[model samples]
Target: MSAFSDVELLHDFLTEAGDLLEDVDSKLVELEQSPEDAELLATVFRGFHTIKGGAGFLEATHLVELCHKTENLFDKLRSKKLLLDAEMMDSIMAATGEVHRMFGEMRNGHQPGAAPVELLDALDAAIEGRTVAAAAVVEQVAIQTASEQAHSPVVAEDDLDWAGLYEAVVGVAPRELEQAALSTGMATEAISRQAAAAVRPKAPASKAKAAGPATTTAKENSIRVDTVRFDQILNLSGEIGLTKNRLSCLFQSINAGVVNDDLIKSLDTVVGQLDMLVSDLQSAVMKARMQPVGRVFQKYSRLARDVSRQLGKDVELVIEGAETEVDKSILEELNDPLIHLVRNAVDHGIETIEDRIACGKNPKGIVNLSARQTGDHIVIEIQDDGRGMRPEIIREKAVEKGLISSEEAGQLSVQESLQLIFLPGFSTKDQISDISGRGVGMDVVKTNIQRLNGRIEIQSEPGHGSKITILLPLTLAILPVLMLKLEEQIYSLPLSSVREIIPIEEDRVQFVSGKPTMVVRGEVIPLLDLATLIGRESNPGPKVGVLAVSGDRACILAVDSLVGQDEVMIKPLEGIKPKGVAGATLSGEGLLVLVLELRELIEGKL
Candidate 1:
């Protein structure tokens, strides 16, 4: 196969494997509830079987063997030879995790190491009713089988045609070849004889069968088209849009001058139809770049389980809206941030059994990881019923780290104090653990989220759990922003950050210690002049555009004017970072504008 074909095959495998892995995690959770579920057991077994088979074809031996052992264990359970219990479920889930890790390694061009020899040994012991080291693989595979009086015929090991079975099991030949062999009633030796007899003549038939399924499947679902092709399509759509605009302009000019009634009406109708077609095509192409959030959520199950076990805590992760779709590029960048957040929740956010007992809380803490669509944004929340943030302690830590002055810390609201945890080199952990609290993780999480032009907010109560919400655009490639003007230059602010645009009367604003303060709805809100913040030495405009910022603390941004709202394509500001710019966007009229980073702007004022 050509290089293109190889890449296409890999892409298909990745996409399918990703989905299966997601389903496996979800099913594992379901099995926890209904440990004796026959259908869930079968579904998980088949999923592992398919993965093992595919891994074999891809020459991923470690993955194949690991999954093979897992499949065997499930097979035993399904046949009513074992019992479903917590220990057994944990071991099986751990093995599933190993498979997931191996797949990741293979994707990154590395050879995966074998599953812990002890793990496999424990599995064997579980099958044979023996014990190993400290951990014993539980026997959890009992299922209801068909009644013995109506026993189904069982083919003896030796009675079966071993050679044909081997070929089919190993997938040495294409699926069609195996199907054709079954259909023709030809033994392995008979197929070999037929191949030798015709030599050249039979070659085409064999090749046809070998390549037929691959080709047809590739045409239907396997082909990995180049991203550049999508770019080219986008360009064409843009050109078509521009053409329609230009034609409309011409029609308007013609109508004003000559008023050719029939031609003008015909042109208008044609332009309308063309516009709709172009719009539909653009939407379709954009949809191709979207993938379900389940791809990101699935890996967390294994992480949550492992971390909980390691910490000797009983924690359950509940996920919702796994089918929520976001752009593929955004999904790719979301992995690390999501992992960090989930790990933090399990490690630091959720309390252990003893601690929970002391606090009079549930022994098993629950961590809810959910996603939902809000307007054009996808809000992903990680909420836990663990010991929540102590704002006073966070403030003290921030002061110790020299992140904030004592005076500044005193003025910080509980929410503002919680946000300080995300500051660089700041950690609330009393001691560093392998899981978290080294202070290096959350800063990276914040930066990565910001790089995607998303915002992160933290909400917590002293005794209640903490909730971290990450609001991201549906697609980072294009964003809806509110464009504004400062110093006669255009700028954009993400609509997610702009809670509302309100005009503040000059008299309503007062200066407190040379800082602007406005009382909106009986609450004193600090206002920062955008022009002054960006180092633009200009007089303040009559009207102040107040942008409501989202974070631990809320602030109002006073800008000169609200230019307008626009659907702008966000372009990253490379090299020299603009002092107060979060991103750059092109206006509908094709002009570049700097997007203000409200968080940074507010921070600077402090």
Candidate 2:
């Protein structure tokens, strides 16, 4: 049997190899800085060596070849034989990337193919460059070709002549196979194979079932399941939530006192116990899916280093609160957004080395990325102590992009001006660099955060520095929400964003620039009727207001009444999800209530 047919072994190899690749990639970046760190060099070498062994066992020959070359190079570096250089580090990083790609290919059930000879040759050249500075070879064997070959020979994604070809290949004589099909020139005629297949009796469905997806039926099956059983817990928890709908119907039927007090007490006790059990299960499952954000943060360390080097600037990435844990799903979705933010920090937020020195700032620019659990949300801040954003330049760019009129742009508050950065098609750089100048990233970051029920806040000063704060929910699947009523229609607001529920006073209301404004604790905040925001008729009677804040901005949402608070399982809508509505959940009353996307609702109005 093929090594990959041993599903258990293959999964083990994939998991271990993936981790090794990440570790080696990070160590390679560190080794670039301290070329002589023998300890780090040894760690990286072993990481590659172990992966090579596993790949070899899996018959992933191409991956083995690439890792073997990297391991050998690291071995030489560790022994003080071949010294590490920028060019050499680049080659190693590229080789590691190829190894990662190979793992992905294997994961998708594709046979691993050879790396481009150019890449293998580049690895050889980088190792050789210690003595000869193999510039010619490195140029000849470019990583560009490797990337091209990685996904080369794009063919029609359809099966062609599978049955006939399978029979032709299998029908070859044993003697001919001994001589090799190539030497024997055993090319089967297409017409003859088709005729033979036509003449052959059709196999029953049982035989076809036995054939399945692979060439052989001897392969055993195994699966890689999450240790936390998050899916299982979530599925069962969703079923438990249906009890709300049932109870709502039951209460409606029992409104006439047909149900006795004893029965009510019994139902209440059972439900209360079930709720506690479900909550415990949820916590346990969430804990299982909870991985330290450091796993994602660690990747950016190498990314920031590489980006800063490419930009020819001296910058250090400081990571904090990496041990803070979040849902695995959140971590995966957060990766791209974080990458864009970090790259911008390296390319745009930081000043050039010479400029920093001239300004009497430290030659080394600092981009600090940090995450911490604040209440129900995880706050991630990417702050840089480099060139800060100037509101004047932002206003000019906003006007140029037709995002705002010149006069309107001029009137924008500092906070509002900083927000222009998150508008699509707004970029400050005069010249577009390969890294960031397309002006497409920040807006996407904001959109993604909001998709995850999160918020992004940008703060910058003319000369001090710039800070982008992202506030994200602990998880996207479930949330604790305060269910509210707007004229008999139910709605839910994220409990974390709700600061306080207060009564709306007729006299305290005033006009601020023609918008409704109210004072709370001597601070005036813009107020909007929640009903009007969601396209319902405004309620004129005395109303309750929910004070909600997104980052530094605060607003009051006027609602008809507060129904109470509950934990909700928010199911995403299918198509054309309406604005200001993230998803829907069931109120205990058996009615589907829209979960208010606080960011969209407040931002659109205020």
Best by TM-score: 2
Question: Ten residues in a row with the worst lDDT in model 2?
Answer: 150-159
TM-score of each: 0.66, 0.70
What's the true lDDT of residue 198 in model 1? 26
Model 1 ranges with Cα > 4 A deviation: 1-5, 84-91, 110-113, 134-262, 265-291, 325-333, 358-360, 400-402, 405-407, 448-454, 461-464, 482-491, 495-563, 572-606
lDDT of 2 by residue, 362-386 (tens): 9889999999999878999999998
**Candidate 1 lDDT score relative to the true structure:** 0.68
lDDT by residue (58-171, candidate 1, tens digit) is 777788888888888889888888877766766776676666667656655565679888677766766665544424442211101001111111111111222232243223
**Candidate 2 positional error at 329, Å:** 2.8
Model 2 spans > 4 angstroms off: 5-12, 129-279, 461-464, 486-489, 497-562, 573-580, 589-591, 598-606
Model 1: residue 188 alpha-carbon error in angstroms: 59
Looking at model 2, the pairs that clash are none
